[model samples]
Each structure stands twice: as C-alpha cells, then as structure tokens.
Target: MPDIALVLLAGAVAGTMNAIGGGGTFVALPALVAAGLPPVAANAASTVALAPGAVASAWVYRRELAPVGETSVSALTAISVTGGALGAVLLLVLPSASFGAAVPWLLAFATLVLAYGRRVSRALSTATGRSAEARMSSRAVLVAQFLLAVYGGYFGGAIGIMLLAVWSIGLGLDTAASNPMRIAQVSAVNLSATALFLVASDALRTPLVVATMLAGGVAGGIAGAHLARRLPARLLRGTILTIAVTMTVLYFLRGTRAG
Candidate 1:
C-alpha cells in the first residue's frame, strides 16, 4: 500500500515535469527501482507508466502543433515512431551498459544546448550573415530528430528539453512555440516504446503499480499542460533550463557513483 502511494506520487510529479519541460524519467525510474523492481525492468516499467502522460499532454497541445522546419508534424512523428521502435528492440536484445555510460554525457551536452542554444544561434547567424534556419538543412533536422527519438526510446531522461535544444539551435525555433510539437513527438516515442515493452518485457508484472501510476500520470499531465500554457514564455524557458541543469548534474553524479 505504501509502495503504491509512493509510485503514484512519483508518477504525478514525473508527469508534471514531462509536461512542463522533461525530466520525468529522473523521478519515475528511481521510484520504480526503489519499489523493488530490477533496474532494467524498472526502466521498462517507468517508460510504460509514463506513456499515457505523454499522450495526454500531447492531446492538450494538439491544437498548437506545428511543422518542424520543412518537415510536417506527420513526417516527424513517423520518424520518431520508427526510431523509437528500433531503440526498444535494441534494449530488449542487447546489454545496456555501454549506452548507460554515455547517458550522462548526452544529458550534459543537451543541457548546454538548452542553455546557450539561442544565443549561439544568434551569434552564428550574425557572423555568417545567414538566418539560423537557412544554416541547417531539412535533411539534417530530420536525421537529428530520428537520432534523438532513438535515444528517447532507449532511455528518455530529458528528451523534451533535448528536442527544444535541437530545434532552437538548429532551426532557431522558439522554445515555447516548439513545445507542442516536442510533446507530440515525445508521445510518439513513448507510445512506440511502451508497445514494445508491453509485448516483450516484464513491465506489466506489477499490474497494480502500473495502473496507479498511469492514473496519476494522466491527471498530472492534463493539469501540467494547462499550467504550462498559462506561464510567461520567459518563465517557461527559465523553468526548463533549471530542470535541465539539475537533471544533468544529477545524472553526472549518479555516473560518478556507479563508476
């Protein structure tokens, strides 16, 4: 009973974070781990538990969805689904040690991008006398999105923040404007990964825990999305940056302890 409550609380907080920016895995994964699941199973379950939250958040932002650069929302979502499924298959078939070791560095790099991406983009545009959007080809943007979707499926930590960072840096898209698409793409990744896990993994072994988390996730996701829509753009960006920095540092510390 106590464990269920804890998991429920964790899911709520995680869902809120995911809707607001993206650091939910930092909360969900550990909560599941502490609830006595093995690490790999816990990771799978965390993804499963959060899948609905991503979808709910995406729904809340459906009206605001926009094309990413030259790519339509449909094309981007397809790419995310494909890459995410592949990543999930890899997770089921291979050892994750090598990939796990690299996660901290990846988060650190993404955080840096989220922090200085627009400023850097502006400076580069001024120097090159070219708009930031003109500097990155559509093909490059698609490739980057695919790669990030793969990462999201394998072990999503701050994938929403990563998407914002990439679009902001590569296309000079405003974070607030890009958020709806970010949530939608994240939904694609999570749904794909969750489908794979449901069929191939033991993520459903604890049905009650999963159900509790799912309910909490849905509630929190809706509330969080509405809350985010009301926040000022500067405040939203600042919140995202703070979460990104905090998650990156925590991941680095975790890696150090593991090492």
Candidate 2:
C-alpha cells in the first residue's frame, strides 16, 4: 500500500512534467523499479498509469490539435497504433539481457534530444523558412511519425522532442501548435502499448498500484491543462528537461548495476 502511495506521488510529478514538456516516465519508471517490479513490468505499469494523463492533456490542448488536419491525424494515429503494438510485442518477447543493455543507449539518445532539441528544432525551422528546397512531403512526415511512435511505445523518454522536431521540420508548424499534436499522437501510442502489454503480461495487472497511480495522473493532468494557457513555458520546459536528464542517467546506472 505504501508502495502504491509512492507510485502515485511519482505519477503526480510525472504528470506535471509531461504536461509541461513530456518524458514523465523517467521519474515514474524508476519509482516502479524501486517498488519491486522488473524493468519490463515497470514499463508496462507506467504505460497503464500514464495513459489517461496523456489523453486528458491532449484533450485540453484540443485547439492546437486542430491544425494537424483530420486526414493527417487519422493517418498518424493509425501508424502510431500499429507501431505501438509491435513495440509491445518486442517488450514481451525480447530477452532482458539484450533489452536491458539497450536501455542505457536509448536513454542517452533521448537525453541528448531533450537537452538541446529545441535549439536544433529552431535552427531547422529557421533554415526551412529561408529556403524553398527545405520543404518535406507528407509521406516523409508520416513515416517519421511512425518510427518515432514505435520508439515511444518501446520506451517513452524524450519522445516529445522527436515528435515535435518532425512536425516542425517536416510540416513547417510552429512550436505551440506542434506540441498539442505531439501529445495527441503519443497518447495513441501509449494506449496501444498499454492494451498490448495488458494482453501479454499478467505481472503488470496490479489493482492497487494501477488505480492509485492512474488516478493521481488524472488529477495532475487536470492541473497541467489548467496551467497550459499560462505563459513563460520555456523555463518550465527547461526544468523538466534537467530533471529528465538526471533521472535517465540514474536509471541507466541502475540498469548497469543490475546487469
């Protein structure tokens, strides 16, 4: 029961971070591990607990979701769902020895992206703005989204930056508008992964932990949504990036020690 409370606290922090910048699982994932779950099970549990928070935050930003276009949204959502299913299968079937070894590198990549991703994204947007040849096709954008969604479902650290970078570079959208679409798209991936994990793993089906963490996520999402319209976002996002980087490094060290 105390462990579940700890999970809820982790979810609250994660939910707030996700609402501001994404990568909330960096916090909750380690907390799940500390709570006695294996890494794979922790991933599944984090997915389940955080799913509603994503849905809620996306809905709260529904106005931004509009700019994505209905056709593009449908296409991207379908691809994300497919990719997420595949990722879930990979989680369930892959041996922990290999996957565990891979986690640190994945975290490293995500950390790098989150830390300097906005500047790189801004540079690409600026370059695109200055040149006619910088434009990208819709097919390319969809493909990028599909691959990133697959990565998100497999391990959802720093996915927001990757998703937004694709949108900004491929579609020429502004940061604010791209953010909502990223949330919506990733929510689909999370849902698909959560469903698949539930089907594949009985270990993550913890009633008390799931209920508490998810409920806390819902509450935190609401708080984030309420604050989304407020200004000075870059500072908030920077703080989240710092925390995420630290958490990712710690988790990687833990994984290495466990190995």
Candidate 3:
C-alpha cells in the first residue's frame, strides 16, 4: 500500500534486468525490504513477483533459442526446475541469520562474474587452446547447471551472469549464441521457485504489492526484449556491471550495520 509507485517502478526495472542480463533481485529485494518484509519473505516475494517477467523475456527470446551442446533443451529445463524447487525449499528451511550473512558475499561473487565473465572465459579457452566448437559433455553440463539453478533459486541476484560464465568458459560457447539459453534456463529456474513460494509461503498474501510488481514486470520485460536487440553489447554489459557493483556495496554495508 505504501510507496506503491516506487514498488511498481522497481518491479519494472527488475523485469528489464531479467530481459537484458539479470540482477533483478538487486532491485526487487531491496524494494520489498524497504516495504518492511523480513529478508526471507522479501526474497520469496521477489522471486514470485519477478518470475512472470522472466517468462515474458523468454517468450520474446523463443526465436533466438540456440541448441545447448549435447544436452536436450527439455533435459536442461527439467534439471533447472528440479534444482530450483530444491533450492527454494532450502531457502524456506534455512536459518534467516545464515542467509543474511551470506547475501553480501553471494552478491559480490556474482557481480565479479558478471563484470569480467567474458574475459575470464576467453582466457581459459586460450590457455587450454580450446577451439570455438569445444563443449563439455552433457553429463558435466547438466551437473553444473543443476548446481547453478539451486543457487539461483536460493539467492538469485545474478543468476543470468553466472549462467553465461559457465556456458562460455566451460562449454566454449560464444556469448551471443548462449544468451537465449541463459534466458531460457533462468525462466525455468525462477518459475519453479515461484510456483513453490506462491503455494507454500505467505509472501504473496500482500496482493497489492504483488499485483503492481507483476504488472510492471510484464511491461518492462517486453520493452527490454525489444531493446536488447538494438542496444550495444558494451553498453548493456556496462549497465549490468554497474547495477551489480552498486547492489554488492549496498548489501555489504547493510550487513555490516546489522551486525
């Protein structure tokens, strides 16, 4: 009921982040927290509110969906869903203090990956003399993706960036080629988590907040999809990097003060 406009705006930004490159939690979580929800509840609420936006982005990207090496798309989606559901359960079960303490570190790690993921990926490929066509086996990729999905379900500050990093570095995939897969995986992961939260958690009991955010997220996701094709790669990456850095610092500061 309070800061209704701000919540809607934040949701829109969050949706845009999902559409572009991720870090939506950087916006959605804080907005929920400011609205006075506990950290766990805020997180659950954010996942529920932002997932539809991610789904929207995935729809926009349906045409861009590229084949994942050795792994069927259905297999990948199933893995993501299962892992995400497990992770969401863990989030609900874990001690709040433990989650609070981990937030800053998680955000920092994700930001680092988002900031320099490509360079690190390229360097690894070069050191190994890997060819452009090199790819990890299906088994390996599925295992790695499952792990990332768990993390995405539990925290999800920059799941998209981490996925891109894994695909690029481990599979020798091109960034451009992997973007669609990244969106698809994120959509699967978050949607699974959202389904769990909505059914089991009280976070969505606040219907006004949830409704506004969902509407805004849909709008932003659609707009961002259109812009993603037109935006310069460097500029879009820079925008994501900037949001990640800012979020990392704020969450860290909040943790310190709370401690």
Candidate 4:
C-alpha cells in the first residue's frame, strides 16, 4: 500500500513538473526504481507511464504551436519519432549493467541543465549576437532535434528545457513563444518511446504500478496545464530545480553505495 501510494504521488508530481516545464524523469525514474524494478525496466515504465501526460499537455498548447525557425512542426515531429524509436531500441538491446552505471551521471547532467539552461542560453545568445533571420539552417535544427529526441527516448530528464535552449540559441526564439512547440516535441519523443517500450521492454511486468502511475499522470497533467496559466514561472522553475537537485544527489549516493 505504501509503495503504491509512493508511485502514485511520484507520478502526480512528475506529471505536474513536465507540464510546467520539464525534469519529470528525475522524479518518475527514481520512484520506480525504489518500487523494486530494475533500472532499465523502471526507465521503460517511466517513459510509458508519463507519455499520456505529455500528450495531454501538448493538446492544451495545440493552438500555440508554431514552426521552429524554418523547420515545420510536422518535419520536426517526424524526426523526433524516428530518433526516439532508435533510442528505445538501443535501450532494449544494451546491457542492463551499462544503464545502471550511466543512470547517476545522466541524472547529474540533466540536473545541471535544468539548473542553468536558461542562463546558458542567454549567454550564448549574447555571445553569438546572431539575429533570428541569420539563425541556423533548417537542416541543422532538424539534426539537433534528432539527437535530442534520441536522448529523450533513452533517458529523458530535462528534454523540454534542452529543446528550448537549442531553439533559443539557434533560432533566437523567445521561451514564451517556443514553449508550445517544446511541449509538442516532447510529446512526440515520449509517444514514440512509449510505443517501442510497450512492445519490446518489460515495462508492463508490474501492471498495477504502471496503471496507477498512468492514472495519476493524466490527472496531474490536466491540472498542471490549467495551473500553468496562473502559476509564476519563477516559482515553478525553482520547485523543479529543487527536485532535480535532490534526485541527482540521491542517485549519486545510491551509486556510491552500490560501488
């Protein structure tokens, strides 16, 4: 009962975080691991469970979707789907030991990005002094999206933030204007990964856990989308950063103990 409650709470929190910005994986993945699933299985389950929430958030922002620079939304989504599928396949074929070893570092990297991504984006924009009209070519944006999608599929953490950073740096797009597209791309990546995980991974082994989390995720996602309109961006970002930092530290400690 306690475990079930924990998973449900984690899912709700994760869904809310993702809807607000990103870093949901920092919560969902560790909670599943604590629920006694293997790391790889937990990751697969997390991806599958959170997918619907992402879709819901995207739906809420549907009206605001726009082309990323010169790249059409459809083209970016197609690239995301393809890259995410490849990444999911890589997860399925890779040794579990490799994933276990990488988890801590992955969390650390994601935490760092979530913590300073915006600042870094601003710094880059100032350094480059390139106008949006002179932004990276559409082909370059597509390639960057593909790589980020691959990462999102394998172990998404702050994918939304990363996408925003890339688009900000490459296209000089404001975060407010580009956010709808970020949510849409995240939805694409998670949906693609979920499809592959459902067929090829053991994410469904604990059906009850998955179902509980999925339900919580949907509820939270819907609530979050509405809350996003009222919530201050600073407060939301601070809450997410706190969660990311704590999770990253805990994962590092867990790895140390295992080692």
Candidate 5:
C-alpha cells in the first residue's frame, strides 16, 4: 500500500481513538514515522491532518463545550493557540533527528502523567480543597496551558488527560464540566497549530500525504464522535491507557536498542 494510504488508515484509527478518549496519536505518529517521515515532520503532518477530526468531535459535543463558562477557557484557549503556533515554528527550525530523539522522552513523560493522573488529581483536589490557590490565577494557568500546548502541538499523545487534570484539579473545576472545556481548548490548540503547519515549507511539499490523511481523519472523526456516546467510558479509558503504555514501552525499548 502507498504510504499515504497507510497514513490515512492510521489517521482513521487515531481519529476514532481520539474521539472516544485518547491513544489516537500514539497509533498515528508511529505509523507515520515508520512510513519514512521523520519524527518532527511526522508530528507536524499528523497535527495538520488530524485537526479537522478534533474540530468535528468538538462540534459534535458542542452542547458540552459551548456552555463551559469558566473564566479560564478563553484565556487558556488563546495562550494555547499562541503556544501551538510557536511549536509549529519550532518544528520548522529544529532538526528532525533531534525531534525524533526527544520523542521517546516526551512520550514517556506523558505516560507517567497518565499513569498517575487519577492519584495526582485526587490529591490535588483534596489538598487544595477549593482554596484560593486551587483557583489558579488566570495568567498562571495560561502560562501553563501554553507550555502544555507546546508539547501538544509538537507531539499530541494523551494531552487531553494532562489538560483535564490541570483544569479539574489545579483550576478546581468538576470533571463532568471540565470534560467539554478540555475538548474545546484542545480543539483550539490543534486548529491553530494545524494552520501554522499548513503554511510551513515542508507541509506544502507533501500535499498528497497531508490531504489524504485529513480526509480520512475527518471521516473517521465523525464516526468516532458517534461512537463516543455509545461506548462504555471505562472500556474507552482502558483502551486509551493500554495503547498509551504500549506505545511508551515500544519507544523506550527502541531507544534502548539504539543506545
């Protein structure tokens, strides 16, 4: 099969997984890289291609996302968009090999965060307990959101979980409400970064790959959104966690072998 076909297939899987919860890029990115794209380019390509999926999913859940009235959402979205653009620019400047080398560590970090997310979130909520500090300053949260966006745009693996923990625990929002807000914020990050990537030099050079992936992702995204409400939450979360850990270990082992 053509690499573009493979990318499209992977994007469909990614879109489906992302719509339900997580683990989409964990599947998509590696497949792209394995298909001969460098890590940074793969990251940019995947981000650009899969963004439409995020937007579609967000729209499908608009009732949840549109009504999130938290003061932090707008500021957080703004900073995340800025940070996403910066990340795309950084990818343009950085060496592909450097990005590839860094990916394992980044994935590992994301894995660690996911592994301990529930514990950490619970502890934070308990310790903070609706205190003043629990309601982190808008500026501080924006800065943190920016940092997360940088990582997210550069390589989005389990970024939603990280954002969820921050919004719910640090920002003291309830999980049920924070869910939609997280999706909206992530949608903004993906869209902004995708726009940046679309204009980047290399992105245009690989038009077919980007186009097909986008087409597949958008179609798959629609399917994913519909499936999200039907599947059991526990099963979806478990699948995401399983995929995340498997990808993390694979990357770690590859690094070890290379070293």
Candidate 6:
C-alpha cells in the first residue's frame, strides 16, 4: 500500500511538473527505481505512465495547434511517431546495467539543459548574428525535429522545453502560440513509444503501481494547467530544480559506491 501510495504521489508531482514546465522524469524515474523495478523497466514504465497526460494536454490545445513553418503537421507527426517507437525499442534492447550506470550522467546533463538551455539559445543567436525570426529551412526543421523526437521517446524529461527552444530560435515563433504544437508533438512522441511499451516491454510487471501512477498523472496534469497561472512560477520551478540537483547527486554517489 505504501509503495503504491508513493508511486502515485510521485506520478502526480511529475505530471504537475511537466504540465507547468518540465522535469517529470527526475521524479518519475527515481520513484519507480525505488519501488523495486530495474532501471530500464522503470524508465519504460515511466514513459508509458506519463504518455496519457501528454495526450490529454495536446487535446486541450488541439484547436490552437500550428504548423511548423513549411513543414506540414502530418509530416512532423509521422516523424515523431517513428522516431519515438524506435527509441523505445532501443531502451528495451539495451542492457539494464548499462542504463543504470548512465543514469546519473543522463540526469546531470538533462538538469544542465533545463537550467541553462534558454541562455544558451540566446547566446547562439548572438554568436551567429542571425535574427531569430528568420525561418529555418524545411529540411533543417524536419531533421532536427526527428532527432529530438528520438530523444524524447527514449527519455522524455524536459522535452517540451527543448522543442519550444528550437521553434523559438528557428522560426521566431512566440512561445505562447508554439505551445499548442509543442504539446501535440510531445503527445505524439510519447503515445508512439507508449504503444511499443505496452506491446513489448515488461511494463506490466507491477500493474497496480502502473495504473495508480497513470491515474495520478491525468489528475495532476489537469490540475497543473490551472495552477500554472495561479501559482508563483519561480517558486515552483526553483523547487523542481532543487529536487533535480539532489537526485543527480545521489545517483552519482550511488554509482561510485557500486563501482
């Protein structure tokens, strides 16, 4: 009962975090691992669990969804699904021990990206002296979207933020308008990978826990959208970052001990 409760709480927190900004993986992955799942399966299961929330958010934003410059939404969606499924397959095939070893580094890198990615984006534009408004070539957008989708499918933490960053710089799109499409793409990538997990991965090993988390995610996502406006965003974001940093440090320490 306690295990189930903890998983549910973690899922809710993760879902809320994702709905507001990003960093759900920092909470979801660790919770699952602590609940006795192997690192790889925990990852796959976490991906599966959070997918529905992404879809639900996308649905809420469906009417406002926009095309990516010259690239059709349909085309981008196809790329997202394909890449996401492939990435999920890769996760299932990788050795569990290997993923465990890499988990700390992965968390560390993701934290850095979450923290400084926006500053880096501005720096890139300054260095290149290219107006952020200049639309990217269609080929470039497609290729970049495809690669990000693959990463999103494999380990989706702050993927929505990354996509938003790309669109902002490459197309000069306002974040407000781009958010609908971002939600849609995040959903597409997640749902595609989720389909693979349901069919092939042992994500059902703890069906009760999975179901609890899934339910909590849906609830949190809905509540989060409402809270995003009412709550103090800086405080919320700072809390999430603190959790992420602590988790990364603990994971690295554990790895050192294991070594």
Q: State which candidate has the highest lDDT.
A: 1
How accurate locally, in lDDT, is each candidate? 0.91, 0.71, 0.81, 0.81, 0.70, 0.75
| Candidate 3: tens digits of C-alpha lDDT, residues 141-166 | 89989998998888887788778766
- Output the number of the TM-score-best candidate: 1
For model 6, the local distance difference test gives 0.75
Instruction: Report the Cα RMSD per candidate.
Output: 0.8, 3.2, 2.3, 2.9, 3.2, 3.6
Query: How would you encode candidate 5's per-residue C-alpha lDDT over 117-176 as one tens digit per residue?
Result: 556666766776755344566666777788888867766766776675555445445443
- lDDT (Cα, tens digit) per residue for candidate 2, span 1-259: 7887898898887877677667688777888887878777888888888889989988888776653422367788898888877777777787656655665676666666555555665676686565311455666666777787777777776676556545544444555545667778878898999998777785455767777788888777767765755735575455545655675677678776886
Worst 10 residues of 2 by lDDT: 128-137
Per-residue lDDT for 1-259 in model 6, tens only? Answer: 8888999999898877776666677788888998888877888899889888777766666676768877889989988998888778777776556655766776676566556654665677788887544437878888988887887777776676667657765666555456567777888998999999998988889888788889888777767655654546456445545655766787789789989
Clashes in model 6: which pairs? none
Could you tell me the lDDT of residue 253 within candidate 1?
Answer: 94
| Per-model TM values vs. the true structure | 0.98, 0.82, 0.89, 0.84, 0.81, 0.79
Inter-residue clash pairs, candidate 5: none
Report the Cα lDDT for residue 111, model 4.
68
- lDDT string for model 4 (1-259, tens) is 9989999999998888888777788789888999989989999999999999889988898888889888998999999999898888888887756665676676676667666655666676677785553658999999999998988888786777678667765666665556668888989999999999999999999999998889888877777777775656666556555765776787678778988
Question: Of the pair 1 and 4, which is ahead by TM-score?
Answer: 1
Clashes found in each candidate (C-alpha, N, C closer than 3 A): 0, 0, 0, 0, 0, 0
Q: How close is candidate 1 to the true structure, as a TM-score?
A: 0.98
Ranking by TM-score: 1, 3, 4, 2, 5, 6
